[model samples]
Target: MKFYKKITEKSKSNSLVVLVSEDTDSINFSNDSVNLLFSESLSNEDLSSLGKITVLHTPDSLYKNFNFLRIICIGVGSLEEIDSNKIRRAAGSFGRYFLDSKLSNLSFFVDSIKSKDTDLITESFFEGFFLGNYIFDKYKSKKSEKKDVFFEVVSSEISNIQDIVNKSYEKSEAEKFARDLVNEPANVLTPTELSNIANNKTDKSISCKILSKEECAKLGMNAFLGVSQGSIEEPKLIHLSYKPLKNENSYWYIGKAITFDSGGLSLKPSGSMFSMKGDMGGSAAVIAAINAIANLKLKVNIDVLCLATENMPSGSAQRPSDVVRAMNGTYIEVENTDAEGRLTLADAITYAKGFDPKFIIDIATLTGAASIGLGKGNISAFSNNKDFMDKVKLAGDITGDFVWQLPLDSTSKKQNNSTVADIKNTGGRLAGTITAAHFINHFVEEVPWVHLDIAANSMTSSNDGWHNRGATGIPTRLLIELAYIFEK
Candidate 1:
């Protein structure tokens, strides 16, 4: 989807998208027809919700002077409280509402939009609109008839237009890439298949290296390998790097790639295991974000590591109370085979520490306690440094990927104490999310770090324009913005 820019107060359009608020008395437009259309829309539309839209067919007799098939007025609630998020949400509504029709293009009226930063607001609008318009019908026999919709945005306030253009394209395409990967079934995207996909991403702009199971074992990645021993699929330790001409900073990203988690010997109930194919949501997030970062050509050095494997129960699967030593020489007592993602992530983080990055950020769908604690549409954040976490929170706020920090005090660390090994994998039921973070923190060493537990927000129940029924591909935008913040 491309957004062609036209800086004008008025234009002849077939289908137009306009912003509306409850207190919308008038918009100071150079064209009187726009003002009249706004007034007409306010009279008929209800401003009850942020993403609500009122589609009105203007009478041709009264509006023969201007060319328009219909006017779409999306609710933004109040102008005083308007922000980028509201704009994105309202834009999402616009994107999702046009599913039945087929069209080449639409126009958005951003000339009169009230915003603190025109670039930020315009970028947010693009993000919301494109994301909301997304649908995962790859497996459907009959796909959607709607062609890829392009937009012509009219805005006098949009300066530095090329930056918005680049970011908008990169961000949306990156998200779509991640969503498509997550939507792929486990049978199709096994560990080797995922490694091939990662390998294919390499070019002059980026570099990718895949380590075989033998290579991993040579480095004493026993805990990481233990989780995949039951499955016949060969585990892949993928390392992707993006190095610019001048690197201002360096960071590492880790993702858990359990393509199909059957919970091993600790089997999940059939009902709970239905969507286990999305267990690699973290891998998608990390991989997608790095892809965007590299494509945008930001002046930063970054490394992305994904430990790809499957956790299937078999006669050779790791059993209860089994002890496995991590690459960091820390022994882990596998109390429950279901807690397998953290096992893979632990060695990945330890391995990442070898490169001596200035900071490390890992994202994963690592815990159900995250969803139970914060519900859906929110990310659970944990970090050892407040400043780093604050920057991540700012990125989340900028991107509408809401991140809520959880407690990781010393008390949470005590839950993982083990009688036989250095620590146990499962830390009981209480504070499960925090304990999981604490367990991963054990391998992060002294680096300034933040862990994003995206279990709650990675999958959605409804197929809104912004989210599909499965694999929401969250924190991709958030992580991209985090790299941008680091650049500044």
Candidate 2:
């Protein structure tokens, strides 16, 4: 998709999109031809319902009078409820309309909207349009060919529209990159491949380092290594750093990079293993967020850690009741091999503490209990610090990736107690998400930490809101927005 700014009345396109509010009783267009077309359509049909789409097909004789082939009007609720999200959804609707109609070019007129911040409205539109157009058909033999879309956002009074467009473009592309990584099959995206992807990011401010299995063993990261013992592919501990020329404080973001999880010795049923390729969704988000932050040139320093590995079942796999030592010298008793994400995160968070960051935030598809608790919409967040969690909640709100904070109290911490090791990996069935957070908290020590169990929000079954059908890239924008907020 290509984006353009300041589309004029003389602009020629295959299709034109206009947003109509629910409160708008009549249709208005600056172009005389468009006004006449809409006026005729309004007399015939009502086009004021929210999210209602009305298409005006040009008559054969009037093709030359009107520059476009079709005119699409999207109902955008009332003026009072107009916000960036609504504009984003409207843009997404336009993207779908373009695909369904096989139209290559579209002129999106935004000058008619009444909003306090036109820049945000424009940015949200581009972001949603690009994201909604995303499709993962790499393996399809006869894939549907889509023409390159020419997207024009027409706004008269918005200042620096080009800058807003560029920013939104970069951010949406970053998210698409993350989605692509998650959509890849496990046969293609291994631990080493994931590490290579991080290393290939050629940003001047960002530096990446991948620690081999030998190096992790020497550093006493047995917990992370234990999860990789079953897989034939070698595990990699990927560390990426982004340092600004001038920085005040640094933060750490760790992601559980399980490329494919077969549940190790404690295998998952066949029904539950289909979407295991997306276990690395958190890692994808972290890598993509850092890339966007570097591209945006945010002045805050960041350390990104990804524990990349595959949990498979084999002769060498870690068995139930196995005790593994983490980098911080804490022994974790593994009661269920399926609870492997927290095991890798235990060591990753331990390593993150070495940086002495202001706050450490770790993301993972850690528990199904989180899915049961929040469904597929909200992220279940567990944090050791209230102020830090509040900051994260605010960022989530701003980015439209909503988060709900769950308790991480001592009652949940005691559930991970074991007779032999310091703590057990699985803390029974009750409060599983909180117990998993507690298990990671033992390794974080005094560093303020936030854990996001995104098992439900990582992927979806259908296209809704601003997300596509699969690999929602949940919280990628939230992480970037949080970094900017923390920099302030």
lDDT tens digits by residue: candidate 1, 233-339: 99999999888845444688888899999999999999988788888888888888888998888887888999999999999999989999899999999999999
TM-score of each: 0.93, 0.94
The candidate that achieves the highest lDDT relative to the unseen native structure = 2
Pairs of residues clashing in candidate 1: 132-465, 132-466
What tens digits encode model 2's per-residue C-alpha lDDT throughout 1-488? 33344433556576777777766555444456767777777667766555578888865367455656777887777778878887787667655655566677778766656677767777787777777778888999988776865666666666576677777887888888889999999999999999999999747789988999999999899999999999999999999999884544578988889999999999999889999999999999999999999999888898899999999999999999999878888888899999999999988887777767889999999999998988876899988788999999998876678899998888878989999998899889999998988888888877888889999899988878678788988778889889888888
Which stretches in model 1 have alpha-carbon errors above 4 Å? 1-13, 27-38, 44-49, 58-67, 146-148, 245-249
Cα lDDT over the full model 1: 0.82
Residue 203 displacement (Å), model 2: 2.5
User: How far in Å is the alpha carbon of 209 misplaced in model 2?
Assistant: 0.7
- The TM-score of predicted model 1 comes to 0.93
Query: Model 2 off-target regions past 4 Å?
Result: 1-12, 25-29, 58-66, 247-249
lDDT of candidates 1 onward, in order: 0.82, 0.83
Q: Whole-model lDDT for model 2 versus the true structure?
A: 0.83
